[model samples]
Target: MSEKKNTNHGPQKGGPMGGFGAPVEKAKDFKGTIKKLLSYFKPNLVKVILVFVMAICSTIFSIAGPKIMGKATTKLYEGVYGKIALAKLNTQKVSLEKIASMSKTPNPKVSGGLAAIKAGIAKVISETGGKIDFTYIGHILLMVIGLYLVSALFTFVQQYVMAGIAQNIVYDMREDLSTKLNKLPLKYYDSKTHGEILSRVTNDMDNISTTLQQSLTQLVSSVVTILGVIIMMLTISPILTLVAIVTLPICGIATSGFAKKSQKYFAGQQKAIGELNGHVEEIYTGHNIVRVFGREQESIEKFEKINDELYEVGWKAQFISGIVMPVMNFINNVGYVVICVVGGMFVIKKKIEIGDIQAFIQYSKQFTMPIVQTANIANILQSTVASAERVFELLEEVEEIAEDKQPKVIELPKGEVKFEHVKFGYKENVTLIEDMNLEAKPGQTVAIVGPTGAGKTTLVNLLMRFYEINDGRITVDGVDTREMTRADLRGMFGMVLQDTWLFNGTIRDNIAYGRDNATEEDIINAAKAAHADHFIRTLPEGYDTILNEEASNISQGQKQLLTIARAILANPRILILDEATSSVDTRTEIFIQKAMGNLMKGRTSFVIAHRLSTIRDADVILVMRNGSVIEQGNHDELMKKNGFYADLYNSQFSDGEDVG
Candidate 1:
């Protein structure tokens, strides 16, 4: 397995940052969305509250720190402007004094007044250096530093809290989604692509996590910062603050305008991704078949086409979204220019002080900073919302069969099974099993035989309640099956499918899968009974050998036997053997058949057989044709009837293969 590296920059490796190309798609009902998102954090309300408070504090400090820096700049400039003003006044005084003294009869009044004013001006210039009160500059610097430190502390707290919340939310959502999947009606899977479903659970949820981790955090901080900055701006200069407010409309229009284009591309990208995943999944599972059929180039072409579509969507989305950040940055800079140029005139005219103008310039950024943050978070926001919708859609899917109003505990009495006038289909207005009826007594092995697509498997499906009957009912031990809980109903039967799916675990784990608490002795006995112990013993690791992905290390025949052993361990009251021996060779088939006979000794068994020789001794033979039972009786009775069953049996025997 390859290690997962951060691939945020690459197209194929979609990290949290990948979906920036897509803009926020217009989703109706913002209020409802907010409510739904909030519900995810309901359990951690205290943490959420604390995080919000911290965001507010952080915003206050962030806004205050910059304004304080501006204030210090303003103070320095005002002191220079004041000194220049005082020097000019003193120069005027000296010239007036010189003019008075030059008069033939010296005007003492003019001279004295000029001399006094000059003395005052000289004293002012001298005292400016000593007691000029520029020490406030140091205080302002400290204030800026203090605000920054406080903001940083609050930001740290907010980050840690929000991260914890986001992780917890993702964990809970995945666990809930998994549980819901297990409870979903089987037919939901039949009509849906596994890739699409997987995307919702994995990719979509991951998008939500990424959004929470970064964009959501920034969004909160931005709002708080904006609010705090606005308050400070209002306090500093109300008139200049009005000029700062104009930038908002421009930013909003720009963001919303670009977002529209981005969203369209994003939706397209998601669709393309789903299609790509579907194709990839199909190709991988059918790689061997593709090789046998020599369609490697064809598969590659299909993949390339899908990949190209994704690229187009991705490019368009990214291109549109990319403009937002730069554009917002530009607008923010323009807003700063406007504040500086316009506010400068006010300060020069003495309508506002230099400090007020400087503070207003910084506050303008505070006003536009939210817009910048929003632009940055836009991609994540869009993807997260889109992913959330998909996940909710899956959660809202209707189940195949509704649970009983009051389900009863199932108590099996001898394991007699009956299907009476049962009907089922994958969709409405179509029936796979119509008025089908069958009965199996305890310890009786009933074999159902038919050509492919004759609904032999459908019969087993109905018994398992994979689909609900449209017409009649199935019963276990004379009680209506629907009355029992689905889990309890399924617990009565053990099944071995044609295709066995194994998880990554040991051979012992696979065998014990049928019974959660199955003992070591039970596992070994089951394996021995299924005729799998001999082969298992010869293996280097025996029962301890681990399996990976469909038990690929083992042969198909071995997997089938392991399944059989699993069924034997479950020791269900009823059993379903669907092509149980199909994968095995002739030598293994005979031994497996004998082992199956032993397992079926005291269980009600339903066997769907392809080879006639395997079911020759079955108590009852059911011959089906196109979803209808054409003939049914004991093996001997069916042969005597000389109907579909008899013809099939004769054809099999006439072949070169001998049936002893």
Candidate 2:
């Protein structure tokens, strides 16, 4: 049980870094898992292509904004400088005119040359303006705004398309998983825990969904943004672009070192958390047993120990991962300073405009984020692929053997069961039941009595074909069980096991679960026949009462009665009652015994009971020991033979001991 629990409830694969502290679980076959995951998108290939196109368009539009906005800044700067130059030139023109007018018989040639130069300067000043070009700036601003709005629209479309594709693929995946679970053999479930299978279906599937919906789109946009920003930066100034690119290697080394260090702590934290959860689940579910054994304090101490370990590893993991962003930012800041200094030098040397420097700085800042995002996304993909691989593993599990294609149909099952030379085992080398043979006529009540693990229930399980026989044949109504479809063969019988299963619903619904299209009257009649109607009517809501998840609202005996009621409604040709009355009081047992007698009339019944007294009236008693029947006869005949059956019966009656 512990092994199964650990297999199922162990540390789950990590998701997108919850604060970059969760460990990323890598897939054993990364390329294979990726290929399989992509196959799921084949049906949505067109939509996927559309999403990529939209993402690229959106990113390209966004990348153009900084460069376009810089044009407006350039217009403003050129206007301001031109106005200053023009004003200075106007002052010089006035001084030149005054000198020419106040010549006092100056030379004519010199005066003519001065007049011509003054006229040319006046014409140049008039052709330009001493005020800023607000019109051009307004046009540039409008164009930038339009580009941003279009970018946002494209982003919305991209996300909308991608979301649909993700959900549809996940939907198909979940359907396939559900179907596969049903087709899996019982041995698979026997070797696994309910939690483990559920974790694969719920947690692992959710991880895949999250990655497809969010990370896939983000990865595309990040890559496009990186490429687009690089191009824009180079166009602005290749020298500044080179300066920004040089810092990347430093940032990469730092990030990789921190990620490796934090990964160890993150993995430790995850393990500790799983341990703590396991301890808490075990304690809470068995709290009564713990208290009865006086181990409450010990359990508490164990819980505290696990909790402390979790805290230690959790803090270290978070602290280490937390420093990565700050360190990367510092490196980026250094690169930004270098780019700005080079850009300023270019502007002063008249090699580049001030507005171009602004655009390049913006491009440089944009460049680093996508690179970081791509790295983070790469980590997220590792975890996502691991989840996908786990799910695929379950889907690829061995299913039950296929039913006969032309299966024989039993139109009216008579329930004459026979086992001939039957051999079986849970494992190949360890035989539990070997060469076992049994037979029951159409309407006989065959009682199977034995000690625990004596193959009493195994006999019934073989008769029902829950597990296939290793050798020989089992027949129902003179037809080989294997020749009939599993559904058709099992449909002829009704079972009430020791473990009563009741889902969360009304009592009426649970009883009616035995048959399709059962009317209210049919349900009430079955309940009355099982002797459960009286107690059920005494409840506050009677048949309308709702059962909780575990059906804990009802007593154990009441649960058994409900199950009997369900079997009674089924009214199958063969009835199996495996310790059905074990949980009830003696008085209730008598009621149940009478009900079983009535239900068994004209039907073949197999009763597996530990109490020898309960099956004395059965037509035949088969005493099983060591997976084989040691004796078989009626109660009186067995007593007369004075064999193993006789000793088992005498011991139970004389000492009031359950020989079963």
Candidate 3:
């Protein structure tokens, strides 16, 4: 276990064992999954069939060579050596034949019956012109050559097909997962950890891909090869075949027992990784706070704890899985020894030839191989199923918000916005907006002012359809917001929030994000209007300057201004300014306010601000308290009422030190 101390602040390392939660205690969905997994090979069915055919051919040829050689041993022993021992019989046959023959003298050795039989066999051989017949040898060589070629060809084809299928399935899974993520609401992220989901999509999927490609293919080949070998062994000597089959139960018990320990440890390893990633993400994201609060050592201590725990889990899992291979191999070797001892006895008793014994030894290896392959395949199967369950868990996430079934398009002629007795909350039964009613006619600027958690931003979120209203209706141009497509409803407004989210792209690209096909002129004009063009031009690459993630290279004020420029480029009928000037200096705020003035012309706008001065010119100001409106009016109207809004205004604007 590596000490969890902050190890140079690099990304937490978990190469193969990165995922979340414990491994399953029992196999789930195995039957359905196997069917689905095999379906991927359906397209390559022809190639798979060819591979099986070639495997059988190779196995049969490999078995036949020794069988033929064993038969040849018996024939040679009887014909060559057996005949040499019959000298007396041959001498008697030769004397008889010589006395009987009148035309020519016969060899006295060939006179006897046994000698005559040997002479006749020798004459037949001699008639072939001393050319030894090698047809059987030629046939065996041809079979060997065919087996070699077919095995090589099929090996390539099967590997290629498996790799292709695995990659394709991985691609499809990634795409589907990504689409699901995009569709899920923002609330889903609020409850889940990013590291956990990232582990599933990347590490888990990769495990499945690698396992399916290698283990699955080898599994198929091993099964078919073992079956062919067993058939040959049975035909030759069923007793030896039975001896081979006895090794399987021992292997099954050994591997299955090891697998239980391996899975437990492996699952623990995955959980430890998720925790490590989550802690690392938190520390890095809050690095500044950790340093400011002087908690570096505390953070290091926590981090080291996770790292050390991961090491322990990893070692245990690897140790258990490692034991399986050697144990199975030992069992296989023992089986071979038993077969050898028994088969050698048979050979001495003349029950089987030496070649047959040799062939049986090879068959024993084939028989044990399938069991080994099955164990390995089972290991991979366990891992892939764990991964699949994670993937399915994500896919099964409850949808946060539903889309309109028959969404109506937003119309240009009617842009009236209204919140008619609307009620909402982030969580159920906890209302953030309760029976709230407000209206912003076309070309009117409505501002909302309140303290933190007073539901100001929550109201804006409802208008933007980021969350659903708990009660009452939100309408645009007299059409209920829920009846319109989220896209069309959102298209009616341009928003600039406090947290400026910028992708890695050029300055020109960020500004044009709202209007996809926005022209260069439109971008430049929008930037100029938002007072972002001067800073953008000062950059080394001018408008072409690319931004890193979240536009980290720029100042906070610069990012806000860029986001504002994006909204301006959108040219929406309604503008939403959410703390647009909060992170900027007074000078930048003045520039942003001026830009807002230009953008708000002829468009209904909603401004949610902590800075009280920004809302002084608003046509109407709404003060909220505890999910309901407390006061409503323009600045003067609210000031005269002398309630919460009046007190807020006095505190923010009292000695004329500009509120931000």
Candidate 4:
């Protein structure tokens, strides 16, 4: 069945809405997945440490800014206030001197008060010269600016180093995924949709990359900022620091509540996106079929349904998560009011300076942001961990069975093959083929004919070891196929299936894909032999014409011919053709048959055909029914029997069928 038909279009089970909805994709083992993810950082440990140091330095420098700026404020205030005090004190000094001079018998109280007044006035005049001191404030401003510049410099360095670390780790992850994909068994591919597998490699990996590049460093900086701000606030006024902290529990409660509500919606959104992507990919690839069947409206309707669901969940997810910041800001603002009132009282009591009050308020504001950032990062980390777990799950999947430690070598393959007592099934306890025995001598053309799902393609799959048999062995040149490496075993055969596969590339490159290091002359010769050379010369670019992603530029018959050319270039000792000429017209089929005949001249060949007359000259013909061969003989012998083969052959021609 097509993968699209097999896809589950509905939401997944075990969601918050019971068993009928899409559940959030969470890490089954958060700690374990995080540990595995961290392993990727080992190679860049030094860089990670440096990033940490830089983050701390940057945050510390930034945290010190408001406190240092407070000094400038204090210096300016002192100058302005001192000048005003000096003027007031001069008047008082004159009055006190006049009173002292009038009281010839100096009163002790008057004498002490007058002397103290004169001392204060002199001190104020000396400090400010009865004017504001701009020089002192200028120095303080420069110092603050210098600290801010250094902070910015540290931030830039940390970000640059962190981006490199993130990319390197993602690069290694991508390489590992690529390698793992190649090593995985064919059954794995058969069981998964192309979109599902691609999502893990592409979407999941991208999520990890984004989180690492942005969120990871932000998490570190947010933490340091929070700690550093706390310390600075405490230094300014411990009472105000306590007031700022009292609001944290409320922020935490609000964030946790919103995150819990939005997380499931986020998961639903992701699931819906996957479904939408799968639907689009499937419909696009099979658009021609859909148009022919007139199902465009149906496809659009299905798309709308999925899209609507995505929109619903997306808004809910975004709305719930979005409110967190505003709500947090509101709570922090209330806390800000409380801190201001308390700091003002302390200032009036002379317990803290005016500059200290200003610094404390700045620190209080700074304190709330990192807490919010940390909460947001926590949520992002949850999603990131979920993505990481998916990647790790793929890496940990069971791979193909290991090759033989000391595999036997095939010096020169002659294409002799045998399947003895072969019992097999795609699943256990459901045998598709049982007690099958077959052999083909070197250079013999053996044809297999059968109804759909009659084990015809299954036979070829077994020969190539795309699947392993349940009980028995297949041998090539009298050596058990299992004894040889899969590469060596598969390398001996060339295949051209009913469904052609051609990658996007030039005609020359596509044909050359059949054999490594194939010369240009070899590619053209193979094309000529498959009768593809004529079509190649007819194109505007000839062999240089680039096929699009779907290879839709060429006719179906042309694609088949190109595949045949590729098989020809391979020049394998064994050839397997499963309805290789099914897509072509009679004339093209005849030409392909001729090319195939020449290609199969000295190689053992297995031809699987639906057309009864196509394999009339086979050395041996095997007719399969329901997983077993019901008839085995050549054309003349099978016709004499008037059994299944004869009946099938006669039916094809009985209704005035156009026999080519």
Best TM-score goes to which candidate?
2
* lDDT, candidate 3, 1-660, per-residue tens: 222322121112222322212243333777765665566567667765765565555445554555555544444443444355444435665656656575376645435554666675466445432232356446655665665666666576667766776787788778888989987776788777676777778877877787767776677667766777777788778998888888888877777777776767876776777679778878888899999999899889988998999999988777766676688789889988998999989988978876677767766766775655565466567767766767777877876577777778865735588889887788896767778888888898898888888888878878877777778998888899888877788877888999898999999988999798999999999999999999999999999899998688999999989999999999989888888888788888888888899889898988898888888999989898887888988988988888999888788778674755
Residues 16-36, candidate 4, lDDT per residue (tens digit)?
222212244467899999999
| Alpha-carbon RMSD, candidate 3 | 6.5
lDDT (C-alpha, whole model) for all candidates = 0.79, 0.86, 0.75, 0.86
Model 3 lDDT on a 0 to 1 scale: 0.75
Q: Which is the winner by lDDT between candidate 1 and candidate 3?
A: 1
Question: 178-285 in candidate 1: lDDT tens per residue?
Answer: 878977887889887766788788877887887787777688888777777778888877776877787678877877887676767777776777677768877888
Candidate no. 2 TM-score: 0.92
Q: CA RMSD for every model?
A: 5.3, 3.2, 6.5, 4.6
Q: Candidate 4: where is the Cα deviation over 4 Å?
A: 1-24, 91-117, 123-135, 253-321, 655-660
Task: Give the TM-scores of the predictions, in the order they appear.
Answer: 0.82, 0.92, 0.79, 0.88
Off by over 4 Å in 3: 1-135, 159-183, 189-191, 196-215, 253-268, 303-313, 389-407, 650-657
Model 2 steric clash pairs: none
Angstrom error at residue 354, model 2: 1.7
Error of 2 at 46 (Å): 1.3
Worst 10 residues of 4 by lDDT: 13-22
